[model samples]
Target: MQNMRIVKKPGYAVDSVDRALQLILLLQETEWLRIGQAAKALGVAPSTAHRLMSTLVYRGFALQDDQHRYCAGPALHPEPAVGAERALVAAARPHLEALAARVQETVNLVERVGATARYLATVEGPQLLRVGNRAGTILPAHVSAAGKAILSTLPDEMVSAVCARQPPHGGSALTAAEMQELQAELRDVRSRGFAVNLGRTEPDLAAVGAPLASGNRPAALALSISAPLSRARQIQDPAAVEALLTCCAALRLELETQGRL
Candidate 1:
């Protein structure tokens, strides 16, 4: 005769709070849940599941229908601001494109990623022959105007940590004293509301970058334009600087109003 084995129920008990919360998160992606189905899936008793659902409903994190089903409640979700970075890119793209066309220079969107500044997007100038930095490319924060513009808004300690974490292009990285001097330069950037990098990242290349803010995150985005050093000198022109400032102002307004620029 074939051996027959009987299976025994596991003695371990799952935590009720975690299970209920997991169900809540799962429901976020779904429309509604029937009591029987939800309880069965959670491996909990119907009465216990009903009590948990009642608590969620009481707190406005869930709602129950007359048909005896539950759905997510208004309090379960706050206005989503988590995708602010993507929103920032979308918000800044048109302006960057227009500016690139007008100036015939490479325009880029840059953001801080860990200890370095990473390119978020790039729009090339009118010239058929143009150099473009790929999105996700990173550079030292101290070297690039696009990096420095955003760095200028960070706290001194945080800036020091970031710079100390990586060596500068030429040597053993910036000293604390040198970091202070660089901080002074950033202060100027703050006052000027823009930063200038002349052959710091790439030889014979010059760039100008301005900051964009959203909510309490200061200088969350940087807008930049780059050109050959000779052509970059044109950035010193009063009219060009004015135009850059105007664009920065517009970006700031857009970020403030739309909460993403």
Candidate 2:
């Protein structure tokens, strides 16, 4: 975190542009914003707020739902997960269970929190020698299977912004060369539709992961399956990959049904 605070606006800032962006920020914070609420927040008239939001809707940055309340639009959200991570995880549990059962490995639901991937849920497989549950575990996004999997879906500049920070557990920031290497790996992940971590997180653990929804908007969450390194190959086998992708399809539909995709 920075040590000192800078003013919200510089002396030469443009008021209209700043206000428009402020409305966007407000939409990010609030699940559904009303015109009156926006006006109250911006210190502007209701009509002015409506006009500004209407313009946002026209540009696909905001949406006016059937209730005439405003919400962040596809262009602005792309993932529908601002302040909704818990809901998304709740919807994903069943699918994770199905995947774990099918693959007989530990399944993890990971949310990308800046440069770290926080495990939201986990389902352990039945094998005697299997990867343990990781619900609530946090790992460097760059070094995590699910994290790298989701990062592959973003643009290079955005990836840089995400991995530009230090690891959540405490470490130096990623260097430029490391970012380049990770970007290269991400390019491969994008083409393959999955990512792998071979004993990267633990000495005896290996995993495979992919974005929650492929060929669509970027997802804030990813699904991964882990197994003991001695038997990790099974998780990457064709059957496991097929099961994982099939589960992703089902989970994506659930999210869409909830208006979260």
Q: What is the lDDT of candidate 1?
A: 0.73
Instruction: Give model 2's TM-score versus the native structure.
Output: 0.66
Model 1: which ten-residue window has the lowest total lDDT? 164-173
Error of 1 at 80 (Å): 10
TM-score of 1: 0.61
Q: Pick the candidate with the highest lDDT.
A: 2
Which sections of candidate 1 miss by over 4 Å?
1-85, 166-173, 214-217
* lDDT, candidate 2, 107-141, per-residue tens: 99887878877677788998888877566456788
What Cα-based lDDT does every candidate model obtain? 0.73, 0.81
> Candidate 1 lDDT, tens digit per residue, 1-261?
999999764567457767778779856866777777778878888888888877776555665542456677655667553245557778888988888877778888887765566677778887865656435455767778888988888887878887877532223567878788889998998887789999887788888987775444667678888887888777656666667767777878977788454
Residue 45 CA displacement from its true place in model 2, Å: 61
